[model samples]
Target: MRPISLLLILIGCLWSGGCQQTRLSFTQVETPKVPSFTAPTNAPTLAKKEFTPLAPPEVISLSDELSLHLLPGTPSKLVGIHLLAVSPDAPYENLDILHTALTQLSVKLANQRDLPCIEGLTIHPSIHGLRLSLKCPASALAQAVDILAQSWSSDAYGELELSRLKRQLALDKHIRAFNGSEIEEVWADKILGSAHPYNKALNNRELQQSLDKPQLLALLAQTKAQSQWHLLLEGVPQVDDSLREQLTASLSQLGAQQRQEERFVDTFSPYGKQLFVIDAPGTVQTQVRIGYHLPMGLADQEDSAFACEALSRWLGRSFSGRLYFDLREQRGLTYGIYGRCFNNPMARILKYYGATQQQHTGAFIRGILDHLKLAAEAPPSEAELAALKTSQFSQIALRQDDPGHRIEDYSQAIARQAGSDAMAARLKRWQTLTPEELQALAQAHFGQEPVIVIRGDLARIRPDLEEKLPEWQLKVTSVD
Candidate 1:
């Protein structure tokens, strides 16, 4: 299959469905020569390096607007390129132009890098600018970066690249229609309210109308002039002096495009007092998505986020989370219940999603809210708190071993509204929280505003939902 085709399929599987359970195969294992098992050891004398937010050995400034963060020693020969473009401006208007320019840049970069993976360049565009990435051999690192520095370092967009982006966009639209829905939007709209600054969904018609050469060129210029840039290197800590010179030379003479001249924060808040129902008539089981803008505490204060994260993991992230124990392990309402928190400078929201029969939708949602309410009201029992901390600490240790995971974890903090210090603040922040403080923190944010969204057969589920929350207004929309 073509790389793009394979990538889309992989993404579809990851986003729309649950992971397949691992079935162990004893048949693949050979009997030991002694037919004996070694006893497990928790050696007191063994010293292990615990994980901390990785700090670069040095941050090399390439230009006033750019710097290279070197995460030195690595066992692999690949150079990881994490180019984060943070836009101080919000409500980044005309995302389509920004996206198209990026697609062109990726094509050019991949051609130069000879990306071994099926998916070469990854672009994650948010309300801000974007996080663009590529990984290549350490030997060709300079060449790869030269391609990048040369591409957007000036107003060099051409008619050919624009045509290529147009074709790909149309092709992508058609391909996606044959696939499943990108349901993150559904959850975001229901939880954060569509008016949230970060919730801006790019409109295709608007993009197509604005695809003139002058507009595309202007977009590229603005990106160069206004957007802020940073470099994060993993697998190799210190870069060669030659590479540093190249980066500095390029940065010093790069493009003049500037960021969008606006900043915004979404003031829209959802009242947990309301219940919303949208009818997707033909589906047998209802799909549920409940969310609220996560507490601002998650973004600004280390102590607040640490507490909220502990609560989040115990409540939804792990198999042992409360939602799994209550909704799946006990009532058998659905095969799974998933909850998570997403944060940016402009907004942060806690969202939970699950599916069940129409008759069971009301009870499940009510149960979830009650669970959230309780989680906020009091600290987890000693056992629950220990489990949450263990899971979190273990995951942190494991992440250090996986370069990809480390890159992604590091990425989240850099692109957020918070400056680069976000991750640094999170380190050991959990260790500082008292049990009482943790619960108090969760309570402070959880009690704010909550929005309940149910996509089900309203004719069958509405009455039950109504019975559960009597006075709440339920907004219904047509799925078709």
Candidate 2:
């Protein structure tokens, strides 16, 4: 009985020991500290430091107010001012009010005693607001900023002349309007297509009659108090902590005001094909523009963009571009030739333009189409590809030489919804593309039909040329 009891006790001890070993084994196995799977903790370190917000020159209670951006450079400075207000459902004619406001602003800026210190001043108006740009020697930026800030404040414009000037210039054509010559030709072309919201350009007559003081006051009364102004300072010197604080304090004084949102409508041709001709009689040569709609943004296919770049270089882009070689060099038919594909989120248009001898206009058009066909069919040779790559890379490098370019590039990339690394990635992708890939892209995009416009003496070439291009119906209009 005793021996049996001892055997039972030994078995019990062995079982208990085995259970203890199992627990120890699990403990030794260890939980992994997965370095690769760990969430990043250094994001704050990697993030760019935020700019200290600065006080604006002066605080204006008016809904529409000017905001300034001062970018300090090595030996000069750039100043940018944008007028902002809030008016949603404003009449199309109200643009005249804004136009007049801008003209008054420009005249004031141009006449300022401080103007002499500025190296250059450029006053232009866009859909958003009046743009006042001034550049001066780098050392002068601080002083300029001080002067501008003071002038923009409420006390700067005195009570005496506001009413008198408004009455005198109220009917003045030049004061209230933009010269037709000042308008970009492309904007005019778009205006010709549609007479709606897309037609934003102001002519002399509309500027004179559109907005009076009462309307302006009414619009201002409805303006939102918060700011819609965006201030961008690029290529500015890195300010020390003390100076940065001062800037912030000065800029913060510019009170907040909401900006008006401008709406744009897309314009399309009603007819399958339309031709408009402008007659510039004494011009030595004709200018031809061929436009086509394309996808608003880039394609997902990497090769598509590469192909476009290569085709552009080979055909009309580079110094030895095919158009120049064919039309200007070999045939001696034109003084210059070029093609451009202008792209935006809303539209993409391809245009081929050149100055050709009046006699060769028809031949020049034919030659351009023929070359485009050639690009579609043939792959670029290795030599041509190398040249294009070199040219593209060199151009990109040259663009970066300016500090302003870096800021602009970053801004545009943000606007386009592309990644910050887009420039570097595009270069890399272009480097990897093969000749076959580019050829395929050309075959896809370059073969489409284009809408053509010619500016020249229609009587000189019309009857004969119209017979040759039967597909293109021509309408000739005198410039006068």
Candidate 3:
């Protein structure tokens, strides 16, 4: 409710007795009503997009070094250009240079374009391959493709800004210290893991020893032109005749395709029960990592990947999981802990990592190992299996509503020469897993004794650790 105010004024009469006779002047002001807002429903599930996968494009044979897979779709104005390059990890000269070049190229492409900027242009160079992914506006797709072709064809482009790359060639000491500080990363990368060609400390030695411009250039050319590469284009915009001709000419220069298989498995064997104690001075809290390598990985038996992940969740992630209860709820040793099966192209590794004080380290290790040995022999409880399935279903439901999810799956499938739907179908299999099957999976993969790594102030806890596990063989190393 609003109060109405009125005023009487005399225009041509004196203010004495004319007040009542004066004309009354007033205005009615209407108050505006506020709009009521109805909140959107917090629905449990999103309506999943109908399954519409890209029809397979004719595989273009470029050469022994290159192959192309094209996927056409109705969505307009956006395109993805993916590049996968495979090479032996030898010729460590340009390892850092590859990282430098891609970062430089990503920046160059993003800025020097009128087309929707190249977004998420990432380059991950590894021992096996370099995975490159970029999304651009459909309007500039052809231009982006031309630029990629030029990156190979031009002798000057990758090396255009040599001075800039030199600055980033060395490892940031701060980053190195930080990673070393995270004791988990150091153990996997430094102590237990295979020697990386691009190891930062090693980079300083290799970069200086092999700093030949001509040699580096030759290596880059050989990498881009001769070595095998896979190309996957998803959500490619419809091309007019002019654009089609441009693309054909641009990609054809790479010369026919040859398919290759990854038969090389990492010859890795843990040096049994060796406890590597890295000395991080002034550190009161210790980071402990324990696990062992599996002989075979997901690639060897793709069907078991889901089961591996589900088991990982049951042991580590869920509130009711073993690691959570043992490390956090019961012992109050650490805030969080993780145990998971890791898959590289060459191997699968079961790893557990967590943080704890010097006093609790002994208890944490014993508790984790007991669980590991127990899980290997026995079946998980019905409650645990239910928790694992609940997580799996939640992930499946989310993926269903995600068209991008399917697109990514299709692209990866094409790269591995696999059926796109194979990954999704495994969820159904996860539901039907019997206790025997789960136990077998655990025993088969994790039956071996693990390599334990501890990084902390060794001076503080060495006596306690030795006293706790007297029979254990412990090898101590400095974090140099």
All candidates' lDDT scores? 0.63, 0.50, 0.60
Report the C-alpha lDDT of model 3 over 300-370, residue by residue, as the tens digit.
55655554565676677645567877667766767887877664434445677788877776666766776
Summarize candidate 2's per-residue lDDT along 394-464 as a digit string, tens digits: 66665564544543543333333454355666777667867787777677776666666677667666654
lDDT of 1 by residue, 62-144 (tens): 76678687764446566777676666555455676567677776666556545463146677666655666667777666655
Indicate which candidate wins on lDDT.
1
The reply for model 3, stretches above 4 Å from the true place, is 1-77, 86-95, 110-116, 124-127, 154-159, 181-204, 208-212, 225-227, 237-245, 254-265, 297-300, 303-308, 318-320, 396-421, 478-480
How badly does each model clash, as a count of residue pairs?
15, 14, 4
lDDT at position 162, candidate 1: 61
User: What lDDT, from 0 to 1, does candidate 3 have?
Assistant: 0.60
| Quality of model 2 by C-alpha lDDT | 0.50
TM-score of predicted structure 3: 0.73
The TM-score, computed over Cα atoms with residue i paired to residue i, of candidate 2 is 0.62
